[model samples]
Target chain A: MTQPDKGPVRPRHNVKIVRKNNRMEIPSSLDYLPKVDQFVESKLKKLRIKKDQLVDIAISVSEIVTNAVMHGNKNDLGKKVKINVEASPSQVEVIVEDEGTGFDPSSVECRLDPESLLKEAGRGILIVDSLMDKVEILCGPGKGTKVKIVKLLR
Target chain B: MKLSSRDVGDVMVLEPKGKIMGGPDATVLHDKLHEFIDQDKKKVVIDLAKVDWMNSTGLGILISGLTTLRNNGGELKLANVTDKIQSLLTITKLITVFEAHDSVDDAVASFSK
Candidate 1:
């Protein structure tokens, strides 16, 4: 959407979009979020994925990346978030890795629970898991959580 | 994200165009929701027809608005729920919490009843 009405692409920080070794890496800061989303969307478009599927994958990417930026890298800005995408004609796989202390993904409370429903957080994982066909949280041993997500293209 | 609002009788319809992923955009929506509360507007409808998609942060903004409005005896409703968002709500079990409508007109009409 290069429409002038959409305004200039935000460059509010030293956010960088790198295309190296078939992967993308961004600083672990919220400032880089918009750029990351844009890069991911463009890559998805190149893969010829349709609209509805694109939205789902985009939302999932944002959720995990935000967690990596905030919870994983703790917004250090010095650390970096690495995103790798491998797509075939039938499905897509995305791996987002963060440089921060990892935690148990299972420990997160269900947002669907009545007691937790109104809480304004903790729903990112839920959304990702629901939208993607498969998700694996690879973390521990001081290695940051690497979220691997797979979704089938319809 | 961009947020705009207009009055439909006593009800207010808010149109947020673009992605509500988080950061400054999320703050805009949160601040505007509180602004409506400060204005004493009891009924609010967030038209999502233009919203491409939103992450958990977006969902959080909606929940924050809904709970805050309810606390103040006001109410928040959603209209033009996109398929991706609808799926998020359904999976989060929020479909049971928020009152969602198919259109802005219908959402505003519900406030009257």
Candidate 2:
């Protein structure tokens, strides 16, 4: 029987190209934010996402990744942050998973009152939600905190 | 972030460039605002045309600047806010707190009245 021909080298994520539905891991570093930006930009550039849309998506991704690195990983550096992207014709989905113990989202305060306007900080997640189409966090159990964000393509 | 300032009439215009992440970047903006406050220079405008983006730490600095200026019997305002930064402000509900203008000229002109 003739052996099936092997194809040319195919680019893969991480050290190994795990098939779709498989997961990849990344170091939780602030510097890694730029790398994430490059990866997302390269993946989405061909789709003709508008410049404004790209920026919105990119910024939202950065905010969530930063949270994963700082809050979830606690800047441990030794711990890892995992990001998975799944792109479909109609929408793009991204999952950011951090190993740190998760906290209640409801507890994250938003001082939106007129008196609290001059105060700084506590707005990263709020901005991410406003920019992204949908954001859902799944935490608890052996699975770490997973922040899934989606953006429409069309 | 690199911050440079100049006097626009009686008001001071602060120009900050690059990202305003936490750490040293936060200190510079805060210290400068305090320096101005000590000098009793109350009217101020932060020209944000060049800032790429800032996190919560950066937002804190702006808040400190505004509050410090106001306590000193002066005022602080923002000018030329980019979409990225503006979105952050809106999300934080800081949009309600700050008095922002479309341009530095408008910010400067507002101080006259």
- TM per model? 0.91, 0.74
Candidate maximizing DockQ? 1
**Residue range A20-138, candidate 2, lDDT tens digits:** 34244556656555556657777777676777777777777777887888888887667788878776668878888999888777777766766656556667787777888999988
**Lowest-scoring 10 consecutive residues by lDDT in candidate 2 chain A?**
A1-10
Residue lDDT tens for model 1, B3-111: 7788888888888899999877887788879988998987999999999889999999999999999999999999999988898888888899999999999999998
lDDT of 1 at A104: 82
Candidate 1 residue lDDT tens string, A1-154: 1112332236466656677754889887766667777777766777778787888888898999999999999988788999988877899889999999898876876645688788989888878887889999999968989999998987
Clashing pairs for model 2 are: none
lDDT of 2: 0.76
Relative to the real complex, the DockQ score for model 2 comes to 0.17
Predictions in order: lDDT: 0.85, 0.76
Sorted into a CAPRI-style docking class, model 2 comes out as incorrect
The list of candidate 2 runs beyond 4 A from truth reads A1-32, A141-143, B1-3, B18-42, B52-57
The best candidate in terms of lDDT: 1
Candidate 1 runs further than 4 Å off: A1-11, A15-17
| Cα displacement (Å) at residue B92, model 2 | 3.4
